[model samples]
Target: MSPKYTLSLWICCCTLFISCSANQPSEERSDYPEADSLIQAALSEDLFTGAVLLIAESGEIVHHKAYGYATLYDESLRVVPSPDSTTTRHLFDLASLTKVFATTYAFMALHTDGKINPDAPVSQYLPDFNTPQHRTITVRQLLNHTSGLMPWYPLYYRAAGSDDLIKEILSLPLSGVPGEARRYSDLGFIVLAEIAESITGMSFDEYLYDRVYSRIGLEKTVYNPLDKGMEDLVSTSHGNPFERKMVYEPDFGYRIDVDPDSWRNWRTYTLRGEVSDGNAWHAAGGMAGHAGLFSTAEDLLLLLQAVINPVSGSNDPIFEEETIRMFTEPDEFGNGLGWAMEPSALHAETLPQGAIGHTGFTGTNFVADPNPDGGRIYILLTNRQHVGVDGAGLYPDLRELREKMAKLVFGEQLR
Candidate 1:
């Protein structure tokens, strides 16, 4: 089948499944007028081109709504178009969610089966990491971003070629003593990828696909969309801020447009059938502990449901109950394994103390509150980066929309 036809068929199948499931109605179908109103307001304000917002309570999908066009073009600059409907299944560059979906989850599975010890020195897996300073870095430190490795060091720049990337990464200097402090580091996850590979004797992507995604029925989630016949569902964008236009580096090729001024030619570099992150693309978009994974809002919700009910439909939990607790619990820095713990000012009232979730740099955010009687999950996916790359305030607007929806659903002030 053609890539476009495959995606169209997948979207149609999911939509039909949802419609059939909804007709059978359970606890999830309870009226949520306020939630509906909030989503309507967001769509009316043009905050999102298209979104699939679902709310579940007591193991039921109570609210599911799709809005906006799958594709919306800007006449002045000819920006990449957005998806027209929730069923359209636009590809979302998962950004840091890779930390959880790719890295943390992998480790959890390994740790659960006794394949790895969190406190063991990383050198045990990757022997090249035997430098005195490196020998002390434990798997636990890497999981918590306290590995003392610099947050990131542009391995793409240091490595002479793709084959040398791992060598260059192994030679990086430690930024601090391992386990001394918490500093979110992409490099940490990159190293974790190497460790996972060494221990499993399989590619990182293979391990995740066969173990995690397939088990959860996450058909649309994968390390790289290009590999999975997802050429059509992918979204494209310009660099942020609209000032720093994208520039092609000889080594890294095309950048993802994180600065301003790139918005005008955003479509020129529209990454429809490619990975957006230069590092991931250069690495061929396989599993990376740091980034790389494309999925839609509905697929993500399925993953979250698995997180909530780890033992449901599967005997093996994605994370041990303890590990899941650690991923959701806040550290001294208020960040968990791959998620942010604290609520923004906008949703502080609605978000409980133990609420856990993550935000993708590409205008995607999800929050799951496990407050038992009143817990709710909110997912908002957009391509605000499509408008401008360097823009920093887009999240606040997204948060406000989520707050509004929460307030409407719960019938109280969420902020």
Candidate 2:
């Protein structure tokens, strides 16, 4: 492989491909025709430059395919002279999916070992949430997105380091009353990580790997894949332009209360192997509970097997059925501890009722149809940011594609 370069993200407009068929023929056929067609349509629409899809039924891989280029365009959008074809092995930023496989799984592991209690106050684990405003919040509520925490904030702008970031997050006022509403708060998950760290006395990632991942057969599933000698990852986004816009442009819709000028540091380069989330990269230093995980569909399936089928392949099940169900069964709030219960955007209409799943920014998804007899695990990993955002300064939305995938995987099950 030729040496890769990390060039300025906003440098140039890449050679615009009219469609994903620019390098490959759209007429190509695969065993999984519906999935192939869906991805091809998405690629033509510039949903992403590359993607990998894997479907496993009862822990058995049924259909696994890769599409498009791993590094189709450079930071400036100029087409790469020799872009690498995406493969199942290439890691894609799992984004918010990290909340499930890494952080949520961390919670499940702790619960299984009797080291943690979902009903317990988070303040008991991390003093950061001990304030009266956050005192009533429970660990389960954080997992359920009912902690009343705001959906997001750019804490990196205000904090000096990870510790300060945690403090700042816990210090923030709530968006609603705790346990009374469901607000998907990344800060809540960040606090969840703080709780995990305080209990384990290890870095969040280290503890997760030690307690759960290491026990299972997840090799490529990891935090900071770049430092682990994983350089050939699917590219994601042209720098943090979208995040910057969120701060600099009030109407961008993120609407953080802080001044945009507060944070001087910004990444101006295209990302590869590096995390795509501003919080995970800038504030949490490449690893956090809410985001910043990298993995391939192949490796993630191993995790699915352990969580769903109780078949760890080469190891013991990561969590018992009871523990897994506690985290997978969503309450009235439509959240299962760390997982999102079925009927969510990804699992809606097609997946079995009460199944568990999660979606990621940067175009990734993990869903499992938790049928008692047999289940299918659906994973779609894409580099939605590789081609850069459209005129609206937004990455292409893959929710429609995600929904289609679930429908494709569960044809007659659609509601």
Candidate 3:
């Protein structure tokens, strides 16, 4: 054959190979197509404004995809989101995941350092936590959500600030005796944060950064994202309308109302770069144990990856293997220390029996096995509440979208 003809033939062969490879299902995408499809479906339904979905298996990232808009509007301009207009780098309110990432990790540090006892009563460190009913609430009980504290109270409405809030929480009566039952409680983690402060002589955010984040290679994870000038942060809710109504409306009698959803007045202003949880923002001033922490999905996945591998993967391990085990192990309620274990909705329908994870109220969640060898991690971060709480009321099934995502990822392995 002539030299030109041979070169042309080689070029044609290369083009055909490229086309075939492009059409082939990626080996890296085992269950990712189903998972990505689920995310797209959720985005189409406006289940969330935007999301950063990441999946890793056997210590390698198999999938990392960003979707939808970081913000649908700019001031007054309704901008259509594209790759240039939107990014996965936007910070999201981690909400309750702060329990594990900040509060729980702080406690684990305190426990490892012998600075605090897990079994010790809260009163041991905080003697003013001397409410008769709360004297028996141990640190372990708080960590495990067995402290019998209510899941939440509108302390932001009742108290002027953190000082008064702590006073109110310490004095509040327990709904049940300590260790009698497991009830997931923000109040418990708030108290845990307080306990951490009492022990370290530093604020929660300061202590968390010094002890956990600063050392863990998590530079972007932070509290008070607005203070850090993170203006592009993913927006949540329309100015906490439900909370404003509960706090401000005179018909509610200027008291903490029991039913949050059954209220009259609601705010319409957009809540961007603000902590969505009322108590965390208003009462604690955007620094709390249970909520307030904000981070990117990439930052969170770094932390999660460390938690899974713990030993040699990161330059500094977040926790020792034993401590990690203790935290991820199942409790009576199938909740791990700060993490949720098997049978929790966060773990999806049919994940491995020992998979552990946690979900944030702001549509953030990460479920991981952390077995090192065959471990899998799935993370979804979105500003779902941006559509307003009322949207969920109209579209009640919207909340189940995470579980559906999990089911899709796990496929037939889900129980």
Candidate 4:
């Protein structure tokens, strides 16, 4: 379908929702005072510069709030954070969330359209994996991270361009036999991105937006926010010390050597609206399957709604409910196609099994409960990287915060 036609259809759907009582909000507002307190505490401690927290219960938005500042530091003037600029609509670099929101959706769309088979060997499309075992890696294995691929690599330093990057990813030796382990491999998703592009004969970003997100009515999610005329994004990272400095310096001509322990004389210019992931920004130009999609909390809710339930009555709905369920259902390893299954410490232990979500390195997460008894979705977006990479290592209490937020959202259900 054409972009124009899909947009018009989305507008019609929005109008329909607004006209009906389905758009009317519930009378009793969900209280999340503890959640608010946690955000304030995080901000005061400089753990996160800003965040957008969103909660959806039974398809209705209950809590949507923004906290702190988007662009906190001003290196030019050496001034402290100014919060007058923070807004709920600010775009955030959703680090690894790109796996589920973009790459997974693209894979699902191709499967639904009969353009690709989940069980087929990825080498069928991208034949660079010429070895016996490598050639046998199925699309399902890649999605479930059972492709025996390495978890990650310094692709930014290794590859000269996008083509070289994919080659570098394919050249990595298998960590184990495919389908034997549950290693979460970014390399697999990188290959999956290539598979999607190879199948559709389009760029990964183009295929993702044109084929998946646009059809599902996501207007704010994008691959390269700055390139697409979007400013006002949550800040992340101080500078690319690893890739840009250690590998290719003049852009980041502030470091002498690659030392994870060294801290003095480090470049501290905050990354505002720029991707923090070295592989995605430096190698892929802010477009990659493993990372580098920017989106707002509200934009994500649209995609979550489609995932939590079926998108019915539309001619070009992105994927069938059955397809979504199939993809989200846990495999033998307790891993979904792209989602991280719940009963995780990320959510309340009392919540039923089968809750699913993914977390980003930039302190962003979204989780949804599949059980009908407590059907809810929660999104927490934080630019925790604003304090730089070392900050994340130093303050590794994010899991604690997530657990608290989950408990607050789930309320007395945990009791």
Candidate 5:
């Protein structure tokens, strides 16, 4: 062959090989058309400033996507300075992921060691927790949020200190009979934290660090980054949606980098390196059994993996196989231990059986279905509170997005 012709043929062969390799499906690619569309839709609506959404089935992460910026320049615009790379780790507020990792994990550790009993009354550990109607409240009731306690109370403003806070929380009257109905209550979990501390002879935070977080190999998951040698990497939050514009004058909260110190005061408090929930933070951002956990998407996925397949890890199982089953399954009120269970197809024509997970108020959610042939797990972490705390409507959008993504990956609708 002529030298020019030989070279041309060699180049064409290399190009063909590259094209074939690019088109070849690696293990990572699983069908997820809905996931891609949902993420793009969330970005378009500004419903989430940034998010890390992942789906795993049969012990593999089938889909992973990162969208938007860690911080926003405007309500609809992303920050100019992106991470070191597109895949760089972004610190998410974690909102209520704290309940699963901090609260539920603490309960499991104590239960596994025989340090605490699920059926024991709260007054057994917290003597001051006694009430005529609430005397029947048990550890299990608290964990399942069926203790008939009020959903939430602003004990932070009413109480002077930690002791006062506990007293005030216990003093509140019950809304209904214990276990009569399912009422999601943060107060129940707050008392549960106290019970864990009283029985274990260690603070909830210390107990978790010693038994759960460290053992689980979660390097970045913590109650408060300020106390964990993580002064940096904490994101600042706007006090209200309009603080950036009206309250702070022209700065509009978004125009300039937030000055953490200026807004650290009690009023217009900007949450940075501190717990956002006032009641939970007042408890020192420890394992509150209700709120106060901060983590990244990767760290949370590790915890979920343990929950879904406990046999794969060397660390002790957080809950026994039976206990895990009980915790993840629906109870009398369609909720489980720290999780909300979806109804079976027979019970609710639109619902799916064995679909269990929890959503955090701070814009975090983890859902998992563990049927051997049809299991799926998803984690969506966002700082929806970045704008402020009032617009809870974003949760519905999140739910819809998750449902759509799940359908795309699992080929079955969640509801």
Candidate 6:
């Protein structure tokens, strides 16, 4: 499909949702006071600067609202005077949620087109992955994060450019035997994206927009929102301070294998409409498999609805029903293909076993229960980085608030 035609499809999708009574909503009249209060308290306590929350019960939007300030910090990272407020339309960087929404979707399209085999060694597409250890890695192992790749590596310092970043990642030693352990790895997804690009001959973000997201009626999901002419995005991070500390501070939880002074081009201004991830921005230029996608709460809800609530007995544009099942149905490893299942670290233990979702580093989350009896979707997006890090020099972790909200959203179907 041409970009022009896909844009028209996006316009129709946006208009159809806006014209519906269920899409545009006022939460004051809804019964989610508990969730509202939980978010409100977090904002009051400065957990984040702004947020957009959306909840869908059985495909009907029950609550959708924006709260707090969108552009909270100034260039020097200080709280601004009269911070700009946010609307539901403002985009927040989805961070690692890109793994499932962007990269996984592209993989599904490739699978449908008979371009990729889940069981095939990645060397089939990426020739550099032909090493004895790397040769044993399969696409499925990467999806389930069983590839035993180390969780992170700062390829930004080592890569000459995007072309060389993949080579740098492939040079790293595996953390464990492939398919034997379930350590989630951003490097694994970055390699997965390289495989997708190698196979499709398009940038990762372009592939998603052309083949998956736009085709599924998503108008706002994108890799670099500012480059696409989007303004007034939710702010994230003051320069790259937290990530900078991560590099120099050896005891910082995530291992950084590069020298602290290896890279000198650190960003020094507050981030808006730019990806917050170091590798995504510095290495991939806002188009990495692990992070960089930005989106709105409602656009994300529509994405969830596309696969979870497709038209009955119709040829779904994105993937076949069996394909969706392949990714959502958890194996004994406690995870679906690229998605995290319930009881995993990504969700509350109270959630039913079949619930599927993912979380982003920039304080974003989306989870949906596709069960006929428990059809519900909950999304919470907050700009936790806008307020900068706390005494520990880290962005406020949204996991506590995420768990609280998930419990309330799925209270009726808690396992």
Q: How well is each residue in 1-415 modelled by candidate 4, as lDDT tens digits?
A: 8543453343334322322233222332335667667776666555666677888877777877776557655544233544323456779999899999989988878878888888988878888876775888899999999989878666655678678876787666678999898888888888888888888999998988787777777778998888778866777776654433443343433233234343233345767666778777767877888898999888898887666765544665678767888898889987689888745624445444677888887889887876544588889998876644442233234776787777767656545
lDDT scores in order: 0.62, 0.79, 0.72, 0.72, 0.62, 0.80
RMSD of each: 7.9, 5.6, 10.0, 10.4, 10.7, 8.6
User: Which regions of candidate 2 are displaced past 4 Å?
Assistant: 1-30, 311-315, 413-415
lDDT of 6 by residue, 1-415 (tens): 8543453343334332332334233442245767767866777566776778888887777887777667867866555776666668789999989998888888877887889899999888888889887988999999999998889877888987789976887788889999887989999899899999899998887788888787777888988898889985888887888888878888877677777886799998888989999999999888889999898888888778767866634465577677888888887777889988846567565585588899888888887887745488888888888777767887877777878888888877664
In model 4, what is the error at residue 333, expressed in angstroms? 1.6
Query: Candidate 6 has what TM-score?
Result: 0.90
Candidate 5 accuracy as lDDT? 0.62
What TM-score does candidate 5 reach? Answer: 0.77
How far does residue 358 in candidate 4 sit from its true spot (Å)?
0.5
lDDT of 1 by residue, 118-141 (tens): 889988998877887788988888
lDDT of 6: 0.80
Which 10 successive residues of model 3 have the least lDDT summed?
A: 76-85
In the range 62-131, model 3's lDDT, one tens digit per residue, is: 7766666556533322332431223556688888989988898898788767798788888999988666
Q: For residue 68, give model 3's deviation from the true position in Å.
A: 0.7
- The per-residue C-alpha lDDT of model 3 at residue 194 equals 91
List candidate 3 segments past 4 Å from native: 1-31, 73-84, 244-268, 314-316, 345-347, 391-399, 412-415
lDDT of 2 by residue, 1-415 (tens): 2122233221112312312334433432245777777877776667777788887776667777777778888778887787777766678999999998888888888888899999998888876677889889899888888989989888887887787876787677789999998888898888888888899899988897788777774788888987888766888987888889988898888777887876788887778888989988888889899999888887787777777677445455667789987787768866678888747545456777767888888888878877645677788898888878778998887878888888888765543
